[model samples]
Target chain A: MHPADEVLVARYVEEADQAAFRTLVDRHQERVFGYLRGMVKDRDVANDLFQETFFRVIRALNKERGSYTRQGKFLGWVLRIARNAALDHLRARKKWQDLGNGDDGDESAWWDRLPDDGPSALESVQDMEEADLLKACIDRLPPEQREVVLLRHESDLTFREIADMTDCSINTALGRMRYALINLRRMMEEAKRLEHIPASD
Target chain B: MHNGKKDILLHLYGEATDAEELRSLLRDEELRREHAALSEAKFRLDHLKRERPDPVIMDRILAAAAGEQGLPSSTDRKDRPAVARSARMRKVMLPALTIAAAILFGVAVGWFSSQPGTAQVDEPAVATAPDDIVPPESLYRFVPPQPVTPASTQDPRLAWDDSAPLMDMHRRIESMRPEGMLDWGEQAVPLESLPGSGSRSLQLTGSNKN
Candidate 1:
């Protein structure tokens, strides 16, 4: 059987095995990128955040490898890193636009800085092809709910780990996930109804 | 089995895996309905597409991670000294550059304040045409004098005229017939296409209520 992720993390940390690190990246990069792309709704920005996420993990590993401790699961740990980096980018970009950069290109900057209490930012993603409907559904979720869903499903994080990462009670995390599912169902139903109506031309 | 929303959610997600709970859940009608709803939601969620980053991005990430792992390739080693030198220069020059920028900024601000013609920084220049931007003849524009009217002299009904369009919109909405199903059941009304409809404002006002 293949080594567990913790084993790979240990090998990479203790022996500085580049291959082990690469394997870890290969293993989780898709999920990480998926989460990022869903959040940012921009391919280039998602790719940038993906690289930044691994770079952060590498830095943290270098600093405390000797005392490295597996927290719940490796995927959860990396996901927390990616989440923080993505949020930081959002917050920083928000701050950047609040200073009034009114250029045409700065339109996205303004919307990015708006409070993400809801998926108000994902309206643009909703207009993309049907393949992106899933993204649009996830984007429709409140950030906290979306985070819980991504962590629970994509990263396979336990509710306990998700609670810890999000600084909420386990029940709160579970509730967010439940709401996310319900919201996604609603979005799907709406999409189907719209699809059934014949186009004018 | 039908303990609460929490239990139903957990059970639907397969987190509640006890045999006894599963057996009880099967027998509870309310819980079964909840389970079906949750299951349908899960199915919808499963249909979402997964995003994958480009392979080139993956390679760049791995290479950068490798560099951090102290497993730099021969090319990296050769470039190390040059990179270090460039970094060193940046560290030394960045502070100097900041100080230089601060001095230049202060000088510019001082010069701008001292110059009478350039003092109004807050007001944007309103150029009449793109090709020729005429400098304003004066710092302040002339305002035509008006005969002042007493606050009580104006017609009070005119003050509420702004509500006319709002009332009209409300009337239109009240007259509108809803075209589709009610209780969207979670599906939001598609307001996106309303603008092209014959009675767009009415449709938007009506559909949004659904």
Candidate 2:
């Protein structure tokens, strides 16, 4: 069995064992990166935040100076870092505009212009297309509902934890999930209807 | 009784402990239909793909871990108040203590010069304060202790690890970088994006390519 996250963290922090740190990263980087990508809605920015998250974790764990102890779930601790980095990018995206060049004055267009990278490992073209439609539908969800869905589905956090993370009650988090389901069903039905419509020859 | 939506969700997510009850509830035609729809929605959400993080990021993280091994551990972030207290005392109290010592020394020198023994240097006829006013016992009591220079002889004020306070100071200075060079101003997320993003699975799809 794989070592627990806390055990990995303890080894890395206390011993500065590079291999232990690698194991920790391998285990959580995907989840953290996925969360970041979902929040940033861009792959490159997600990668940047991914690095930053681990960097923060390394710094935090190392600063304990060999007396490291687990305070909370290591996944939760790192997720918080990724969430902050994504939030920071989101907060900065509007005013800072283009990263290097300042000329992209339109705030909304930045995310809009990110090209859809298409589907993942599905076998059939139809499955890929359907997955892409669902992805787009999710991407278009109201921020609150989308967040609830992502935190519930992606982060694997309980509704209570999601509520805490989002600064809302458990009931509110559940309600958001319910509403998100309703919206996604509607979007999927709409996509199916559109797909059935006869193509203009 | 209509199953509460929250209960249904909890059961569906496997969070509720009564799996048998949930399974029985789902056997009802109406509840089963509702649950089936919910399951589909959840499946879609779960099916959302993860994009694999780039190898470069992995390499960077490893490199960072290696580099940071020699550096101070950030364990002190939690003990900020204690560190800050020590730092604050050193910054504010040490100088204040030095100034207080200097003032006491200057007062002792002035008082000594005003005594009859030293008054003869200025003018022999000058009347000194009465012996009752300048108590010799009090003068001896006011004498400063001799300074000890050797580290072995010096009294330990704060009996802590010698490296600890230095490490704390280093961490304190390092903490300032967040506001200093690292402050990337004003750029942030759109208010609309505040709720959430697409899904986490996408991070496992491929390289860090957009």
Candidate 3:
């Protein structure tokens, strides 16, 4: 029931309507931010990349308004930009290898450094911890697998779109997602099992 | 054929996997177990905290949008004092500069029009040749024929005499000739051999001398 992305994009491009652009940013900001955060494993860096991604989006919309074919794929387009921005930052900082499995010595340091400001309620705290654990597990994934999981879960892109964006076959994209999910489930189960084991005095 | 791990994943993600193929894959205990684990993982991923970028970042992006559209962005003005000042100056000076330019243009047009030899807009244009070049004398030598005088203003002797005899008129016309020559058809003959020509010639010569 929401206004189509094409309508909002047309309003923004033709009328220079800032509200329409803001609407667009609001609609996809969380997805893009989450995807960037997952990719870079840092909130501040994700914020910067988020801003950069939108800046690139605004500039592209203004410069090449015709390039967006208005097929309701605006989120996918924005996610692609966000992914590229995150990858560029990663490459620049020589952190690309760090995103692979067990390569970086301090791969878990960023997760430990994340700010803990969730709600104080017991259930909310548990949920937050679980979420944090899941995020850490996702971070431990290989870059390709993490990318597929983030694009699929956060952006809700189809495997075909993920493949197209990531330059792989659809089957390869699905395979990556399969491995990522299997790894995450195993890690979560292992963490739960460890939580149940009693410690000696 | 569609019971591969990728097909299971595609079916798990709600992609275009066949319903029958998915049912058949789930019938296998191991594949079903794998499906349940992936489903739990995907559910956790879906429930993962969706982090929004700081609102300040959104404000900056909107400000950029405003700037690109040539609209004023009040955001971040405090941080960019010089840019804010320049923008303020532009807002105040732009119209003033435009008015000054317009006044200067009007004054220029008026000054040029008031200069000597500059044509006024209201006057009808006339095409005139330049005065420095003198035309050939032959252009001035052509005199228009004189207008004929009315009989009342002409000398009586030179007036047409409609009632006079044809021969008398002819002789008169012959006498009025510049030299004593007679019209003999297409040729002019000297009147020296005519009977009265000798005396008339002497008289004409005497009158001419007089």
Candidate 4:
């Protein structure tokens, strides 16, 4: 466990430390955001799920840390919650929600969080072109494989646990990952011209 | 080992505990080249992605876990009015749930006893209801009877099994030539006696052989 995480989890256990909770929020905010963002393939929805995950962890910790089994894998637990939240959100969105709850950034507010600074830092990176191309390829994967890949990359989870989480046999889990890699490689190779441009730095 | 899933494999090999040894083996140039070139691009992506986790994320996780921020406390402080209210709520909810369960049980019992079937749908009959319902009175259920086939006392083919020695003797006797007649020297006299003796012939033919 990271020292920062330990302190926050410990504080979360002891004094209901909001600062410690905030510390956790600051650290994981972007990754969690990016992860959900990638999964739902949307930013605003991802943001909502990310916040919900934190709050749920908060509630659960408050309910009692001891009540949670020491399964020796907290990251997996956290991501499971995140995945569930994202799935729940997707379900809600499909159910045709009204925006009456008061958050206007739905569909109309943002066109791309990719910044207006003329192809941003991501564009400047040597591998940025490759990364984006690769991301697009990853997005093309079958939903099941795509999710496994995203969770594997974006969230730190073991393949075994990913198998368990996804309700797949271990080999099946590994197989999906294998195919995801293969398809990604094929796509990257196909997009070699685009991939090599390195975001045109 | 794969399903076009190079990225995750790369991450797993470099990062997950199981793949540490695998990663170490990749120190070989040929292996690395093979991996990067033709073996798969997914592994390369995974390797790329397996770089150190964002420290900020870990920090945030810890902070949130320890309640360093405005997260709720596990123990309700004795002095807080909220705790008192929650306790009161729990005190109220527990019995409410128990009562609800009891009512469900009662309903289930009524449903079972009023059955329309040939068997008496008595209280005991309702006992066969699932355990989720109240303990049913009747333990009986429509158990199908097991079929029985009586064991035979003995196999009727015993005479055939006992004919092995006789058949062997008969085969040797049939293979006999006048020149080899004496080859059955020890049984030659007995064989002669059998042909001459009516009683022995009758026994050899069997009682029903006529």
Clashing pairs counted in every model: 0, 33, 0, 53
Q: Give one digit per residue, the lDDT tens place, for model 4 in B1-210.
A: 332233335444454345665666567675565456534664455554322224554454556555465654434333567877889889999899999999999998888756776337455556676565634554456557786654433333446565878777655555553334454445545443443345544454335754
**Candidate 3 per-residue lDDT over residues A60-150, each given as its tens digit:** 7877434556678899888878887898888887666433332222323433432233321222223447877777777777677788888
**What is candidate 2's TM-score for chain B alone?**
0.28
Candidate 2 per-residue lDDT, tens place, B65-178, comes to 899434323465457669999999999999999999999999999999899977777663445534436666887676687976877355444556458777687565555544
- Enumerate the candidates' DockQ scores in order: 0.26, 0.24, 0.36, 0.12
**Second chain alone, TM-score for each candidate:** 0.30, 0.28, 0.31, 0.22
lDDT string for model 1 (B1-210, tens) is: 114667777777777777687767668787677677778877765656666788887787677766733533436647978999999989999999999999999999998877867655533453334445545773377758898997545544444566878777655554443443334465676655333365434454445654
Highest-DockQ candidate: 3
DockQ of 1: 0.26
- What is the lDDT for B74 in model 2? 47
Candidate 2 per-residue C-alpha lDDT over A1-201 given as tens digits, one digit per residue, 9 for 90 to 100:
998887887787678788988988888776777777777777887888888777787777867332234765778778877877777777665411223211222223333443244442222223438767776777666565666787777778888887777666677677667767866887788777666666568
TM-score of chain B taken alone, candidate 4: 0.22
lDDT of 1 at B80: 76
Candidate 2 stretches with Cα past 4 Å from truth are A64-69, A94-128, B1-3, B23-32, B68-210
- lDDT at residue A55 of model 3 (Cα atoms): 74
TM-score of each model, in listed order: 0.55, 0.55, 0.56, 0.44
**Interface RMSD for candidate 3 relative to the native interface:** 4.2
**Candidate structures ordered by DockQ, highest first:** 3, 1, 2, 4
